[model samples]
Target: MNPPADADSPARQIDARIAALGDWRGETLARMRALVHEAGPEVIETVKWGGVPVWEHAGILCTGETYKAVVKLTFARGAALDDPTGLFNASLEGNTRRAIDIREGETPDADAFKALVRAAAALNASKRKPARR
Candidate 1:
């Protein structure tokens, strides 16, 4: 049988996932949240697909999750990003996804993360162009 979705599902999932990290997970998630908020005021936090914490300004900009040894940052439109920092991880079929896999207890590149957020915001905003009159 399938389970029903709940409002706090995302938060619960986040807590559970972070808890699996044993320690430092809270700090990492906190930093990730700050990064998204600092990116722009329009960035809204929501419980999106797969019960994940999604940051959306124009669309799904990024997701925060804690792994056993790292925190995962997934950008929805990452493939289209310029990503000069080479911070993406190559997934299946040589596909590079715009993401930063920060170590569970390590400090991330704040400047780089901010830059990526700005870039993502720009990209998402541009997609909202008005129709011709």
Candidate 2:
């Protein structure tokens, strides 16, 4: 039987996920999440594909996927956004999505990462259709 949908809100689910991790992966995800929020205060948080943490503004900004050795943050429109800081080290071959894979003991540059988040949000905003006059 299919399990029931998570009753907790997105924020609560994220909090529980981090707490359940109880390790460096959890810490890293939490830090990145905070940076995402700080960079885009209007961004909305949600859970998708069962447990993946998703952040969005006008559209989906990114998804935080945790793995055994790395925490992957995949930006939906990454290929469209400029990566001046070169934070995207994975999924480079993809035509659309780009990802920043943070390994254990490795940390992403906060300022650069935040800048990327803002860029993504801006991209999403740009794509939004204007209201009919």
Candidate 3:
């Protein structure tokens, strides 16, 4: 059986998810979501594929997925972006998607994470730019 959908807007849905988690995963997702907003204030937050938090600007930037052991942030075009801080550790085998798996008691570098968020937004924006004649 499935749970009832959360009320109102996407933000509310995400909030409900975080509240429901009631654990470290909730706090981690909330913090990461804040970073995503700080990096790209114009991003639109949505819940996709059954309550996964997706942040989008010109296109999908990343997704906040809560699992049993780790809170994974998956970037849609992360393979194209540079990772000087080595923030991305999971899903490295993929050609298009990259993910950072944050486990309990672990901390992610906030500034570097925000930088990646901005970079992903920039990449999405570049795609929407008009082609030259």
Candidate 4:
């Protein structure tokens, strides 16, 4: 029998989750994780809402999750930014929600993703939230 996976290892956790999923979606998610880490070595992986791995620096920047046959990359403040490359899709109408859905064998545009990440970091850094009481 194989030993249980470690929760501390993000890759392992993701792998286990992917194994459970058993689909192309899982593979796409794993690839997306690699891309995020590659884009920013300073990027920290935190388990936020629903045990999803959220990558951020100053504030909630982005979250990646597996969907049916695709990996969804969500940018929190995507609507506020200018997307001339047409890389983002409106996840919701009239809201800040935006996502890019990529499938297996489809190499995500690394440059575009990096650009979005940088933009997100800048936006998060520039914002002034209410001071904690």
Q: Sort the predicted structures by TM-score, highest score first.
A: 2, 3, 4, 1
The pairs that clash in candidate 3 are none
Evaluated at residue 16, the lDDT of candidate 4 is 71
**Which is the better candidate, 1 or 4, if ranked by TM-score?**
4
**Reference-based lDDT, residue 113, model 3:** 98
For all candidates, the clash counts are: 0, 0, 0, 0
Runs in model 3 lying further than 4 Å from the true structure: 1-6, 129-133
TM-score of 4: 0.76
| Regions of candidate 1 where Cα sits further than 4 Å from its true position | 1-22, 90-96, 129-133
lDDT of each: 0.71, 0.93, 0.92, 0.72
Error of 2 at 110 (Å): 0.4
Candidate 1 residue lDDT tens string, 1-133? 1113653654455555555656676678767777767867667667666656787887788888656677788887888788777666534133544677777556767877887888888988898767689
Q: Is candidate 2 or candidate 3 better by TM-score?
A: 2
lDDT (Cα, tens digit) per residue for candidate 4, span 7-96: 666555556776777777777776677777676766766666766768776776778787666678888888877676887864846578
Model 2 clash tally, residue pairs:
0
Clashes of 4: 0
* Model 2 lDDT per residue over 22-95, tens place: 99999999999999999998889989998999999998999999999999999999999899889999999989
